[model samples]
Target: MYISILCFGIFSCQDLNLEPKGMLGGPELFGNEYGVKKYFAAIYNALPIEDFLYYGTNSNNAYRPDNYWEAGKNSLGNMSGEFFNTWVQVDNDGFAYWPYDRIRDINVFIQSFPEYQVNYTAEVYNNLLGEAHFLRAFFYFGLAKRYGGVPIIKEAQDPLAPVETLEVPRNSEYDTWKFIYEDLTFAMENMSTDIDETGRANKYVAAALLSRTMLYAGSIAKYSQYLGFQGEAATSAGMAGIDASKADEFFQYCVDAGKVVETGPYALYTRGYPDKAKNFADLFLDAESSESIFIKSYDITAPGNNRLRHSYDALMCPQPDMSSFVGAESYPPLDFMELYDMPAIVNPDGTPVRFDHRGDIRNGMEPRARGTMYFDGDVLRGKAFDIQRGIYKNFDVLASDADQGSPNAPINNPNNRILGGRGWTTEINGTTLNITGAHGNFEDQGGENNGWGSAFIRKYVDPDRATSDVREYRSDQHWVVFRLGEIYLNTAEALYELGSRDEAFNYIEKIRERAGATITRPALDQSTSNIGTINKANYPYSIEKSLQFIRDERARELYGENHWWWDLRRWRTADQVLNQFRHRVLSSYYVADEGKYIYLDEINRINRSWTASKQCYYEPIPWGEIGKNRNLLPQNPLY
Candidate 1:
């Protein structure tokens, strides 16, 4: 039967128009399980989680007509100063997201759901109803975080409603959070404990989001008042600020939500393949693993959905076959590397890792760090990463000047820049000795990129997906939206804020044990928690000191994963952390000679304005929305 299926899809507006032949209206559509499933699928497709297929902003629609190479990694990492991307935009479009039309779609689904004449089982109907409520809350949470105190629109409004009637004012920040919490609370109460699909949300998913969102609210309530500029917009409508009085109340909510997930089945990935490095690397690769509480699974085998594949394999993967054959740039910096503590040389009692001599960068370090990043002679799976960016004249000889001696000293051999395009740097007698095929550089004749940092990123790359024949294949490794490890961290952070300092250290130990720390969870307590080998340096018993280590641990654990930028922002330390990244110093260890270490100094990476404006907390509401409706003003405080 040739039938037109008029179903709900991810669009900028709400449309309820269906074609005539075997047409399914609300009663017919929601009454059947098959129709209901297809409708919500479109809603799920519109989620703003930056997954495998999400290629963000490209160039200003000019010379590079279809370049979708910007958002996915470079901007995220560069802003955090973990890795330096070749693509740099200083004052770029800062967090431009205003999906009110999509918000309306979610509202329409929720409002119309109860009225549908459903013949399906009550269980099926309720699950869909729970999902609608959860999705609506999730969408609002996204809006509130970016643009604070957004209008609380619950029921679907008429398209032809009067402009004045539609002009709802922005709610208070506290009230907005309460609104999100109430909806999520309803979802937790009503949603199914289990979902058949891998990517579908359950009670655990709601709890994870609830835990994260409450933590954000707690931070805003406690820390924001000290830094934000107070004005008429801030006072008139609760635009950019939160009520400081509700700090502990929201914190308790965070703690309770995290505890709910803690009692759930999720846990840090312990049993796996090889060593600590391989275990950490494969955690992201294994889609079936229990560590992932919520995932956004991608399917390359979907016939027409092949266009959903991304160029992440091309951009983030440093090797030739891995990079989908283009944009093989970006490298990790030294300031980032220091965050990883050495279990070997550094004692549990805040002692420095003993160096054999001067400039031994790799002697004592976390296996997780080596797992996340490339070091000299580092091998991943079966492939060895030969990061020989710093060349030596002889086997016995190390370069006297590894640093850029002069601004005009020239970056090693500029001819070697074009990968295999320029062959053999030096010659003895008549024969040429070619040191070719560098790990970080990939060249297709004219197009070549050399690694800016000393090492290549090794976290998310699935060795199996680096197909020699199919360079365009987007890796289907499921991104962990909320994992057990992060929940543990969330629990610890919330507890720490609530004055349970001893209990906070207790929870952090589990994450340390998973990272192969010298000190295990059993060994750590308030008495023996002096174990600094897993931490940066000297785990002082103070809450402030412990908080710093938690931040360091988050960066080490989630380096390429990158929730650290938002974490820092929540903690009110963006200016403090990001300002330090203005100058990045990377160290290179020769693969041929492990002892011969070289420094690539003076790499300034960060681009942030240090002015302490609380408006930085919330993204600017798009002017288009304000021009149409008068109530979205004073337009997010400073915007």
Candidate 2:
């Protein structure tokens, strides 16, 4: 009988040895409880799908909003088409892969997990199931946001079977949102209130994601209010159909989430060591900080996988100063930098006084260029001729030969650019102390004229990632998928949108308080102005003004943490903000050239890099995916 069973299995099943393992062996492998735990861990690894900044976002220290894009490149820098074409926009074509890859794993785990005979405490079982549900919802939420009507698959399926049953039609955005909300609600109820590692999502993290998802949906449902705004996006088609009124409901969710995290044991990173100068940037460098909610841990000792430090070193390092500057070509554009600038101070008489251009400093009003790079006596006199090379390129000449400077020992000497304690100064305790760039330092490279600009990215970079000036690899610093600060920002945005301006300001102020910024309340709070019912004066830039202000604060606070492009897109002015920076950077490169040197290739690259074409506004559906599931999905307009 056993022989007969085996012989019958050979004819009925594809592989006799692997048969009775439950349909393609899926059940056999996943039926074990231990396997289920490991599978869930993989899902957790995929939460933040991409590190959007390093490859494309910071090309010009502005927002590129596409892959194949670089800071000064004109054509989305399509050196490799994969990054430029698929990675840049939200295309349905590229959309089918990663989200489904994760979903399929989760679905398979769900199907296989039920059959396993494993003892469980209520808390442990609930948390495990809750985590799986949260991940499914999270993946779905991302897909829904990117591709509106995606197939909702909740069970494992036969790979050989026609994808028709599996090919289920696309669900409505509202329906998808409902699923996400339900899943997150389940997670909030079942998951542990506290997680040992900041990298894992707890109730608060789930709540934060819930708030973020709702905010995206609510905005899409309420885009009608700002239809009058001039731009390519003025038309309803440009927006993903977000409504302004949805702000109220969505922001309430954020506030609720914030309350959970606020009451829970999470704190902002406020500690510093004896080296006061290193405090602000240290949180990112350290692996174990109280404030890091979720982290992508790195081991420099590991092979083939690093984090963001390489990218940071490449961009932040200046040239020819032995300060680790490979190509100081991708600095922040003026428009983005200006956002971090404090608003003009006003007298009681209402006259506005421009604040002193003290420059960008960690603690004071100093130019960022000053502290970030140096070109002074020590550099020029001691090592100027020694440091000159093809890549370094005429360091003394570039620094001294500006339109007003001199090559000879006459007026406008290059000596002024030398940065050994004299090139740049940092203010500490009301004292201007000088810092030197001794052998491969980040600070003390020359500024603007010497290939230096105010543009810098600080989100990720590990000292251990690379040895040379060019940090062209991944960094090991953990990426914060969800941080406490974002919860505060989400709450503020939602409250403001919901006509709770006072409440919104309170939340916004809380973030500002954490960041150590001074706040001033509006005399007659205009929080109610943006709601549909109010007949208030539009105040000409008040909505945009406040919104932009908050956006900039988030950028400065978050910098290279990789959220600006998404925020700009959600706010529906990506084209405007990006184009402004593009033009400004192009003009700078041009102005610098009229005097002498030319980097025309760089110019062309930046000028023609990215466009807010309709396709970019909405990503195309993958051709393969549409074929598999024909009922529920269609390509987005333009793409």
Candidate 3:
């Protein structure tokens, strides 16, 4: 250790003695600009941004299985219904944050800022102060979303205070939201719009968060009655419900926030893009995209943190061709797959298209579905990923066994499916061909992959880079936090909720247009091609139908992007949508005799089911925290 000569008071040693506090150098060190910057670094390190580094309570570790889910690969996709994990799990709605020390830093920053020795301009002071407020509000909003209401600690609590004195009671849910609102309003007011720092929170970022969080609060308030809000504290202290009159107020907050953000340089991500699919696919990869409102930049230059960008690719990319680092832990479920518009049998009129041919069902679907998911025949890097369940061998017994819900090993056998580097060779008509579309092999450890029939998960894969030589573990693309497309959807949803139905529909149409979706079926690449277009019908004007459309639209628009889990919860439809779902069949087979493909074999596909209850909607507060603070008594209902 080196010692530095310091004159606490140059005028006199008496001046140093005049200081009432015991420490002289300590205060001066932190009161300077560089000292503040060092403190800020520590604060930044603890912010609950929850982008890539976030890990849920018990998710599987992708790169390091001996460790917990640090990289959190495919966690968002698996938790939401958009994709399935290779290993089946009873999912938990996680709120993996309890950052009190960070908040303490924010409190100190807010209070002790004026005492700093350095001469900071008013703008610098405001920006620093405003950022603190924004972080505090963002952090608190996350708490409110998970716990309904949490203790509001505005001022720094006295460290020396007795435990009894520190045990503050929990605030009501409405109060918690209002607390967040107050902090955010302050932040938006004081923060500068001039700064263009990537990954740094600014006035626009605060507004965007306010827009989203306020919408959540307003909706929870308005729909609590509809969504089953009946709890002891709900009526007592507004813990779980807000007054119905406040719905419009909060909705206006979201609307106003959106308006503020929309006026900026932000816009949708679909201009100069020749096709809709490419336009949609490239949205997340493009770092300079005006669509991104708040971004967490990940470049090859980010020191020692290559894990941030690479975790997602390692978890979501297809297993067959992808590097060994990948887990292949995500694939769209059959029900989720069916939500896309079919390519075949165009809904020329505004009506639902019925499934007449099972084999050809996946074709002719919505263009957005193509942009969102990887289906059975999705090609990547010039590989077709030929995903057929079984070849037509004229042997009915094994096929029947597949229907009878037999163990997957037999179906994975060479006699049944192509196995052990072998293709099923058979003579058909006058020619001999080896049909090699079968792809599956479950992992015994069930860590890396669980051959769930190659539907190959494909949402955030980079199109610009050739995935052929890609696994450096640096996913290297920015994860979008907010975007103008989402804002448009939020505006539509808010307008509808606030009784502006026509306006709502118009906003929805903007998104549909950007997506290349239309009132009727979308046109195909070629007339003869059976591949799908946006197969669904046009919006009907009824509010009920419009609401349903919104539900489907959200699922389609935000699939695998980590938004569905919250959507289902906020809509109060978690119990209904997530309660019991069936994976009845693994992969569908084709029937050539009828000159049609039979995709579903309902007779043999015994139910493979999943269930989540209302309780799964809210996360449980840590038992340790509750035990430590008796004031947090009567733990969140149903805990």
TM-score: which candidate is best? 1
Q: Candidate 3 on 1-639: residue-level lDDT in tens?
A: 011112223113344555545433435534665655555554554555545554433532322233322344435445444465534433555544466656766775676676752567788778778888988887787677777777899776775799887988778878888888889889999988963778777888888888888888887777666534465543455666677788888888888888888778887887536677667877877778878888766675566543434456656655446534554666665566666664432234422233334334446666676777566556665555555454433333333444433446454344544222224545546655434353332322243544354366666776445555445455677778878888777777787688776777777777787777775212211122211111221211222545566666777787776777677666655555555555433354443333333342221122445555666555565567787787765566455
RMSD (Å) per prediction: 6.4, 10.5, 7.7
TM-score of each candidate structure, all chains considered together: 0.81, 0.67, 0.80
Query: Once superposed on the true structure, which residue ranges of model 1 sit more than 4 Å away at CA?
Result: 1-19, 53-75, 90-95, 117-122, 303-307, 319-324, 342-363, 380-382, 391-424, 427-437, 440-448, 520-543, 589-595, 598-615
* Whole-structure CA lDDT of model 3: 0.60
Please write out the lDDT profile of model 1 over residues 228-252, one tens digit for every residue: 4466475456677677888888888
Model 1 TM-score? 0.81
Segments in model 3 whose C-alpha atoms lie over 4 Å from true places:
1-38, 57-74, 88-96, 226-235, 301-309, 344-363, 393-454, 464-472, 519-543, 583-588, 592-598, 601-608
lDDT value, candidate 2, whole model: 0.46
